[model samples]
Target: MKLYWSSRSPFVRKVMVFAHECGLAERIVCVRTVVAMTKPNVDLLPVNPTGKIPTLLLDDGSALYDSAVICEYLDSLHGGPRLFPESGPARWTALRRHALGNNLTDNLMLWRNETLRPQPQQSPEILAAFELKVRNAVAALEHEAAALAADPVSIGHVAIACALGYIDFRFAALDWRTGHDRIARWYETFARRPSMVLTAHVDQ
Candidate 1:
């Protein structure tokens, strides 16, 4: 399997962490790829029309894009720890957390793009609304962290950790830790994991 990704992408990091946690890290070959929302890399266009990073090229020649789908596929292979639960309530909880994490990341990405735009082109109203979503997402994560004392290492947790890491990487000035100390603490510990340390950050 060939995994094309950008080291700094939170979504890509989620798949990497999941691969390590599932003990399948060595099975896939990691290929560094560049992808920009405005102008994506030409190399990726041939494989995926969306030209997104974290695209998985299977040995059989099938390709899978999107980090969530890739991570789920990797999880199914080993069945080692079961990143996504097999049954009812637990599965729903994990999926909900995972969705929340993804949504948080989505808003963060939007906030970042808006910031990159010229000051005159940026919409203050849109930025303000996205900032509020980010804040609410952090609060939601703080509540979730309070319940994860066991450090279950589910798909949701991995995604959430990556989301927090992205904030640290790009929006460090944002100071998300002010009132959401619990989530910050959770991330502090989570970020120290071996997988995270290995694929920490990459400069563009």
Candidate 2:
């Protein structure tokens, strides 16, 4: 499999982290694909019209886009314990956590884009809203920190870790760890995992 990847994209890092956890990292060939909201990758449009990184190309000329979808596919290929729970309450909890984490990542990316604009073009209202939402999300994660630490690793954990990692990588000025000790502690350990250590973001 070939993955359209970017060292700077949190979503791509999420998929890469998931692949590593699934013990399928070696099977993937990471292609450095550059994409931006303002400038789409024309070459990537053939495979993924959205021109997103983390688009996986299968051996049979098929493709899968979206980190979550690609992660589900990777999970299917692994025979060990599943990151996505198969059924019942565990499944629901993991899915909910994944949604929370993934949405946080979305908000962070949007906030970043807004910040990247020229000062004259930037929207203070949008930036303030993103900041408030991020704070709320972090507070929610803090409440779930103990549960996250107790549960076996899941896609939810991966998503949350990636979101936090993105925050550290891009929004360090926010100093999110100041008051969120529990979640910060959880992430400190989670970030040490080989999957995360291997996929740490690079400005390039």
For residues 1-204, what per-residue lDDT tens digits would candidate 2 score against the true structure? Answer: 999999999999999999999999999999999999999999999999788888999999999999999999999998999999999999999999999989999999999999999999999999999999999999999999999999999999999999999999999999999899999999999999999999999999
Candidate 1 — which residues are off by over 4 angstroms?
none
Clashing residue pairs in candidate 1 (N, C-alpha, C atoms within 3 angstroms): none
Query: What's each prediction's TM-score?
Result: 0.95, 0.99
What overall lDDT goes with each candidate model? 0.86, 0.96
How well is each residue in 1-204 modelled by candidate 1, as lDDT tens digits? 999977778888889988988889999898988777888789888888889878999999989988889988988899577999878878888888899888888889889999999999999999999989988888888887777646577888888888888888888888999998888888888888998888787776
* Residue 199 in model 1: lDDT: 75
Per-candidate clashes come to: 0, 0
lDDT of 2 at 77: 100
